[model samples]
Target: MSAPPFIHLRLHSEYSVTEGIVRLQDAVARAVSYRMPALALTDLSNLFGLVKFYSYARNNGIKPLLGSDVTIANEADPDRPYRLVLLCRSLQGYRQLCDLLSRAYLAPRVRGRAEITRRMLREVGVDGLIALSGAGAGDIGEALLQGNRVQAASRARFWEALFAGAFYLEVQRYGQAQQELLVSETAALAAEMDLPLVATHPVQFLERGDFKAHEARVCIAEGYMLGDPRRPRPYTEEQYFKSGEEMAELFADLPAALENSVEIARRCNLQITLGKSYLPDFPTPAGVTLADFLRQEARVGLERRLQQLFPDEPARARQRAPYDERLQLETDTIIQMGFPGYFLIVADFINWAKRNGCPVGPGRGSGAGSVVAYALGITDLDPLRYALLFERFLNPERVSMPDFDIDFCQDNRWRVIEYVRQKYGAAAVSQIVTFGTMSSRAVLRDVGRVLDLPYNFCDQISKLIPVEANRPLSLAKAIAAEPQLKARIDEEEEVRELFDLAARLEDLTRNVGMHAGGVLIAPGKLTDFCPVYSADGGGSVVSQFDKDDVEKIGLVKFDFLGLRNLT
Candidate 1:
């Protein structure tokens, strides 16, 4: 293959929250249409979309460069941080990047932004990473924009020395003020310092047409009116994803900048293993394998359970035959599936919860259908008595991780979670993240507010969008269902713009949240599987990927849902 002309090195997806308008699926499709071979997703401060992006890109024959657009604390002014894009070239680089990103969220935030200090960069030691100067928004770009060549060069040298040969001075042309000057100065600095210059589009949206929607999304996020002069309008329409030909034409005067983008893409060869289980090892007695220990525990526990049901030894003997057959079959299946450790781990925590007087629910989901679960006291229900099929929980025919929805008393759920954390190693366990998107009515309200539309007018239009069974209609569906809503938009230019803007921004991720019930127990440090995030400096830590994504990456999600009635 004649070297792929150019690759996008700094594109953000919806995981960047309101700042980016590009969805992973749409971004990948756009790249394929452009005939590009590789693309990078450098979402702001997190690899929240890494696994999904990686899967989609690889499936579609595109190289996936996993990275983050991280904010680095400015030494002189911590509140004013400079943006930097760091892409992983190896698994070590990935882990280090995860550590840095996790630290940024877990540390005290500067101006509500997740940022790492210079000290953090030095301590973490960047290896197997390809660092990009954040174009016009980076430290060097900021210095160059301010006519401080010395400061710019000094900053470039620091990164160059730190990243070794993996650092590149980034140049972009988005019609932003001083961008042309930045490109020229960055090129000179690159030559003077013998550093490489790489080109990027800094893509926020998929196309130029989505610019207004992107701006409205930002306005909604920053609580600014679209017409407000004081609002920071940092992005431009030209920041959309451009074809390689377009990028080549734009940077024709400096061809190496374009070539280096391809080179960086080629160099970033990180591979992530997906769809394989990474179960944590359960502690067992010496010389006892997980399978053997599990069988021993199940048999002993079942005997105690059966003894209660059949007080007479003769009746117990008759009952024991069937129970013994069922137990052996279940144990064989569990061992065959290599889930003896998983069962042991779940039982350990559940038994602990029970012993400590924390009420756990009878059981929920398919896991209640397992005879093994009943024998081990993971569930209160007896599978055979209730005629619940073990195949529903685990089947030799269909191989997948067995999921159990476990409920604990609302007040004491944390106690059980805490126990699991300590048992499995605190760093190995974390709650999962959830993305909250802009809903239909809420999107209209936000768009209208930013558009400076009247309150009752916006409220009336929003009210016209109906809700059914607590699920609001999508913006498109709402417009179709309510003819009045469509008519109002058709009649008034302001209403048209409001609905137009709202429609585009609808269903875009607006905020991050922790999953209420889902928690992950990794085989090692959680970062080895996925990055962790904390809203507060040092409270609850959550996996950056949500429940579904975490499961795709092979970290089993254990539901520890809280129930008030169970209290």
Candidate 2:
């Protein structure tokens, strides 16, 4: 039995949030392991993991397919629920796809759910693109299942006309009996309409055995008791990545469907590149360069600050030694580092906040070590007076972003954010996202609940595990450090099983929340650089990447942190 020639067109990576078990690198490695030359990653909707996927796949000798699973409203009936899968075949197609997805989310009425209209797709659908009549949840499949084959065929024709030769009837065999019937009907319909057929298993994990862990993840996402009979369980355990051979066996009766997967993979040639940072031009007053403007502001600001601090000093003494030579050197270093605009932009916001009667902190972090920042009103603390080194803040020894951790009064933080949105178009500014992982304690409790263990018993076992807030303790580390925990795990089979499952699920992203104060301001719409997501029920827009990932993509993240101490 030779391996079946097939490539997975609908695969989810870890960026699919809790529902996806395969990491991007792991997914690419799995494709290479299986000898599949190409693979597609259609994670939910956002392309947050595209760069990682593209780079990893290319470096490891595998072709990367850029695709998205986008939700759109039905044309005739606006309330109908369904989504379409679109894949890019060229750079232009990828850009158009991005534009469509962006509009789907940015539209005023497209709140809560990301959705586009069929009309919008018709307008934006370009050449060299492929459309997969989605699996069970797709518009055509739903209509077919609802005894509306005519409507289903009609919808298929609509897409067929829009996508021309780039459309295929998608078939999946996840052990669902309805899927078998749907596949047969879909094949017959395709034969009648002269459309191509493609096979995909809708992979969510690396292998079959991972289903249990994936199920637990699903339970975590739904906030459901794992053992609760009423909770909705996955229709099949076969959602794992099936090798080409497995897919061939599954679709043995329809070899073309299996072969079409390879054909589709060959057709998709989109490659994502991490472009240069698009930092907005900080608006300087007319007739002055940003550097000159910043210097002028700093000079005047320094004199005003000195006057306030030493009002009793004679005018002659003030004029004799007005500017600190060391401070001027620090300013030169800042300007030379190409951060004058960054400094000016930050200072502009802080000044705007202060002028509006919003309380601002003196300063936070190593940014307090810059007299240049002090003079520019980016920081209020005089570094010379505090005996702070400018090198510690800017690090001229090694080029790096000069981060000023600014604090604002809690009551007026949003006003400052609004000012930024107004100053730099609303599309240019956004907050950063942070993922909450299942910590050691959280995993223990969740696993215990799933196993139906007594709460007090689980609490006792958990209490034995020491709490380390900043530094998390692994099970092995805990066992080595705590005698009681090691003894219990060795003594009881159930306790051991609980520990086993907890250990597996621990440190996985459990939920997403907004960063306390980190905001990423881009020169263009944020989606062009990185995907944006809503944060913490606050309606605050956030980048999908954390602070580190944002910097990796070459975007400067400003921490407009709120401090309660100011209150």
Compare the candidates by TM-score and give the number of the best one.
1
lDDT of each: 0.89, 0.79
Which lDDT tens digits does candidate 1 get at residues 1-567?
453489999888889986998989999998888889999999999998999899999999989999999998987977678888999999999999998988888898787877888888888889878899997778999899899999998999889889999999999888988777888988999999899999888999987999999998888878899899888888999989898889888999999999999999989999998888889878889999999999999999998888877899998888778778889999999999989999998899999999999999999888988878998999988777888888888998899998888999999999999999988898899998999999999999989998898999889888999898998899888888988988888998998888888888888889989999998999888887788998887598999998878988889888899999999
lDDT of 2 by residue, 1-567 (tens): 454588888887667775776778888888888988888989887776776787789899989998888787755665665777889898777767766766665565433566777777777766757889886778888877877889888989988888889989888889876877898888888898899988887888877877777777777666776678898765468988888888888899999998898888888887555534445789877888978987888888887777866777786366435247766887788788778888888988999999998899989789888877888788887776668888888866787787888999988888999899998898778888787777787778877777778999888887777768766587778888899988889999988988877776777667767889898888776666666765322256777667767776678888787777775
Q: 161 in model 1: Cα distance from truth in Å?
A: 1.3
State the displacement of the C-alpha of residue 108, model 2, in Å, after optimal TM-score superposition. Answer: 7.8
TM-score of each: 0.97, 0.87
RMSD of each: 1.5, 3.5
RMSD of 1: 1.5
Show model 1 residue runs off by greater than 4 Å: 1-4
* Count of residue pairs whose backbone atoms collide, per candidate: 0, 0
Poorest stretch of ten by lDDT in candidate 1: 1-10
Query: For model 2, which pairs clash?
Result: none
**Candidate 1 whole-model C-alpha lDDT, 0 to 1:** 0.89
